[model samples]
Target chain A: MIRIDQLIKRYGALMAINGIDLHVPAGELFAYLGPNGAGKTTTIRILTGLTKLSSGRAALNGHDIEKETLAAKRQCGLVPQNINLDSELTVSENLDIHGRLFCMKPVARKAKINELLTYVDLHERSKSLVKQLSGGMKRRVMVARALMHSPRILFLDEPTVGLDPNIRRRIWSLIKKIQQDGTTIFLTTHYIEEAEFLADRVAFLDKGRIVAMDSPIKLIAGLGNWAIDWLTDDGMQTAYFPSRTAARESATAKENGFTLRRVNLEDAFLSLTGKKVQ
Target chain B: MMHGIIAVYLREMLILKRRLKRQLSGMAISPLLYLIAFGYAMGDAVQFNGHTYLEFLIPGLVAMGSMTQSFSIASDINVARFYWCIFEEFQAAPISNFAYVTGEVLSGMTRALLAIIVILALGLPFGVVLYYGPLFWLAAILNSFVFASLAVALAMLVKSHADQSLLTNFVITPMAFLGGTFFPVDRLPMWAQKILFLLPLTHASKAIRAVALSEIPDWRAYLVLPVTGVLIFIFALRSVKHARD
Candidate 1:
């Protein structure tokens, strides 16, 4: 569980994370969605105690991050935006070092490493150096490293930025499995589809502020708008939606050949941010 | 508190073998060349504190090696921020500040030791006298540990790679040279002695050189080691703590 209240972060004259509140309940797959420079990473950095908060309070499982950093940090595993791993070390060695950071016993760490390597399908590469691996392999290794400590809460900042689509999908499925295992999952992504497919609830952050927060379906429904489309010899004509019902009613009154569809995250994102979701 | 430090220590020693080999060629070998040319070529002129010039220079070279080594290991902290891509791992881990600082100190000590051995081995027959054998090595390690902590603290104080390198060139290099690696501190002007007293490398070289030369070993040199060690350790600890949380 996590609670963030009125968090304010400033850099010179610019406010990075303006006064904002956020809550994540146990066993939830929560997605933090924002574009570049939307303060998503800053918020997660504060939670992990890697960066100092300018003001306000953040708690992890009832322990304030600033005051009880060790306790808070012990319960969380962070997979940074970039693969933050030791390239020179073997897969098992990577997990070993991470486990030791939390003071995990050698015997316990060995077992954890094996279990994680297997879970991420990297057991065969246990003795291989990270630099010898491909991009997808490295991502899996990073995931395995995070799970080595058996953290109760996992914060993944763009865990699938440049991976192949197959690997990204595999990662999402693994994330779902992790949530099913009862670890609270907090993630940030620029990919709307990722948030939609994996997130139980997604918070859309724009310019350091959360403009909307809800499940994907609910968020799209909240948009209350829809688009009707007709493919002609030239191109597809897409209509705007402030009302799905109205859009549907219009579809009934259209040129009699248009396809009417329910509004989805892509549509909702465009409606909310005034730009097509990339 | 020391577990994280041990993890870092192990990682550096085991995974950085290639880098160590490279550094031995660069920092260790470059100075050993001086020991070679000067030890045999200029056998006539270089003497200090009552010993052959080569004898005086070899131990001094050992001290110099340790100082540069300890300082270079400190540079890895900055490297972690830039390329190794693992700085955030340490930053986010729940380890005590003591562990990180200790790891840096130990790595620096290791590098210093590496450089010292190679330089000593290369300068063996040139008449560089090493009097205290095992104890000399012990003092060398301790001296390096203290200097390493000081170097790491200062390295962390800077931000970018260029800035860190400039500091190493301008600050660490000057400290190594003026701290009496090539000459006795007594020979310097009395005013400069005041400044040398303020630098850890001065005491480090004094302590290490005393042992390498096998003299009775100055009690002043012995007293300076632990005091300077604790001071630098505290400064490093505070800086890491402030940076982390």
Candidate 2:
């Protein structure tokens, strides 16, 4: 549903996104994993038409973002990294305005707002001011507001960055539900577990370049089935093994105070970039 | 585009509805104080264009009130951009830049009109009355348009709330006093009149005061306002686009 070719974004002497390319098919959940300032947000902003590209061609469901901005924008809904609902407006009013911006009819807009509020389980707070909502409740409202227009693709940029673990899981389920309903989702995050649990195809971005891209199982399997960690004079060191028995055999607690565990997506990123996801 | 502009305008109206009491009180207090302090002090002593001081002050108040109230939209824009981050909501939506600008400018104009109504209503009990014809409305709307458009441009250019306040203190407050709202430009020294003549509000006051007194206003004043309004509106559009970059 989204296609980007040779995207290059520059800020004077610095290039934010340096010649990256991606394609997310319809109904696929694509996770873009990166550390801070790794061009993840900039890529999303370019795809959503909020930032202009220095040199690239991006299309949303066949509509060029630069040449056909309104059509391209209409194809996707965005939940930004921050909560941006109007504080004084009621929950319903916030959804109502989004509907209006998309030119939904009044009758249809009301119906859609009602449906989304219920979908996100915010129906009880429909009339409450956004400022009165808790952090989790506010995040749910943002989700509902983004879905008001029923766009084909949803771009969630760090949708659960600062939320509690429980709230983050709730949002994870909501994202899953959105994908199950046949809408393509492009999610960006620095949380390794979020990408591992949610994304169908994950891409690792470091310094404005894609270093790795594959399914969670494939990426982890390529590295190893288990990992052993121990502290050294330089820092922490980890070794990957193909089997649990092999991993246990490699970790000698008496020598270096080692620990053995299953390999995860973070190990893949660490192996490729030589840096932690955090 | 029209629907998107109306959507934005309706949102502003909803906010206006919620704060109606506070806004009405605010709009009422200042103009009433100006009338009481200036009117009773120079009731019979001053004669402007052969009318009593209160009569002359009422229309000038209308001009000044409209300018200030209309330009006050900058505060709202700043709050949206800085605190709420609501501009990103519009940016991600399918709304056009022109639609957003037109919507905000019209909302500002509506606020100015409401302030004009309050001043006019306040004028009645004091027995201060004047003629309000089509020309009067034309002048009022054009005056509101000029300031509202300028407010949008300045709102986009400023970085912080402190910067916004600095703009109000240095630009808007100075224009309010010297724009022929409190005294006639002709009454100022020749050098001051020459500088004040360059102010768009000066032409607005000249045209509004003339029409309020039932005189045929200088056509040049009418021409200057709409032309200036269009130019500023264009500038506001460009400013908004640049801000997005």
Candidate 3:
């Protein structure tokens, strides 16, 4: 559903998104994991037509982002990191404006707004001003607003950032449901667990480059099935083992405080990038 | 593209409607004060182009109202860009830069028209009525267009809300005063006239006042406004494209 080839984006002397290639197949939930300033959002911005690429080519469902901007844009929906809904406008009005921008007919717009509001569990608050809603409610409204036109690909840039764990789980379910409905999702997140639970494939991006890309289970399995962490003079040292028995054996041999646990997606990301997801 | 422009324009209209009472209060107070302080205080002592001072002042106020209100859109754009982040939402959509600029410029012109109506209505209570013929409407629209387009371009260029306010203080406020809105440009010293003559509002006020008084306006003003509006509108499109990228 999305193709990026040798994409390069520069801001004066600094390259925000350097030569990166990616392919997101239709109906796949792809999570992009990175720390702060890791070019994740920049890549999403370039794909969604929010920022122009300095070099190379990107396409959405076969439409080139630069030459066929409108066509490419029409195929994608982006829920930005920040809540960009018009605060003074009602929830219905916000969705209505988005629908109208995409040239949805009035009857179609009304129906879609109702359906999306319901889909996001925001039907009751449709009449309320966006500013009156809670953070989670506002985020839901943002999601509904982005889906008003029903684009083929959805770009979610930290859709659950700053939300509580419960709310994050709700958003994750909503994202899962969106993917199940045959929409390709390209999600950028700092939450490794979120990616692990939701993404079919995860890519670790650091310093404007992708260091690792694979299924979360595969990536974690490739590192090890289990890990042992122990205090050391340097700081903290961790060793990975293929099984819990081996990890337990390693932990028993240690003479300091140690922890034995299953290897997770975060460990895979850290092993590749050497930087923890923040 | 048209749908996107209309959508954006409608959003602004809805906001304006909801804020009508506050907006009308703000729009009415200044023109009322101008009428009281300048019109009543002068008391027919100041005459221009063979008309009463109140008659002369009303059209100038209309011209100035359109200029200020239209240019005021920059503040709204700055708010949306920095505070609301709504501009980025549009950028991520299928809307074109030209469509976005057109929508904003139309909204600014609409605000200018509403301000003109408020000023004209205020003039009625003071027993000042003037011709609002085709020329008057044309000049008002073109005047609004020029300032609205300029506002869009400047809004894109400014980095912060503080910078936006600074621009209004240094650029817009001076033009509001010296754009032949209150007096004839020729009445100023030759050097001042040369400087003020370069402003689009000078031509707008001259043209609007001519129509209000039923005199044949200088054809040069009629040419200057539409030409300036078109050019500034193109520049505004470029600014929107640059800012979005």
TM-score of each: 0.91, 0.97, 0.97
Return the top candidate by DockQ.
Answer: 3
B36: Cα error in model 2, Å: 2.6
Q: Give per-residue CA lDDT, model 1, range A68-145, as digits (tens).
A: 988999889998888778887788888898888889999999888888888888889999988899988888888777
Query: Cα deviation of A164 in candidate 1 (Å)?
Result: 2.4
Q: Each candidate's lDDT (Cα)?
A: 0.81, 0.91, 0.91
Candidate 2 local lDDT, B1-245, one digit each (tens)? 98889888988888888889999898889999999999867788999769998888888888988899999999999999888889888888888889999999999999999999999999999887799999998999999999999999999989988899999999888988889888888988999999988899999988898899888998988899999999999999998888876
Tens-digit per-residue lDDT, B53-169, candidate 1:
677777677777887888787677777766665878987788877888888788888888878878877776654546757767766776787778887787667767888889888
TM-score of 2: 0.97
lDDT, model 2, position A134: 94
Q: What share of the true interface contacts does candidate 2 keep?
A: 0.76
Error of 1 at A238 (Å): 5.7
lDDT minimum window of 10 residues, candidate 3 chain A: A266-275
- lDDT tens string, model 3, B201-242? 999998999999988888898899989999999999888888
Q: Which is superior by DockQ, 1 or 3?
A: 3
Candidate 1 residue-wise lDDT at A82: 86
Worst 10 residues of 2 chain B by lDDT: B40-49
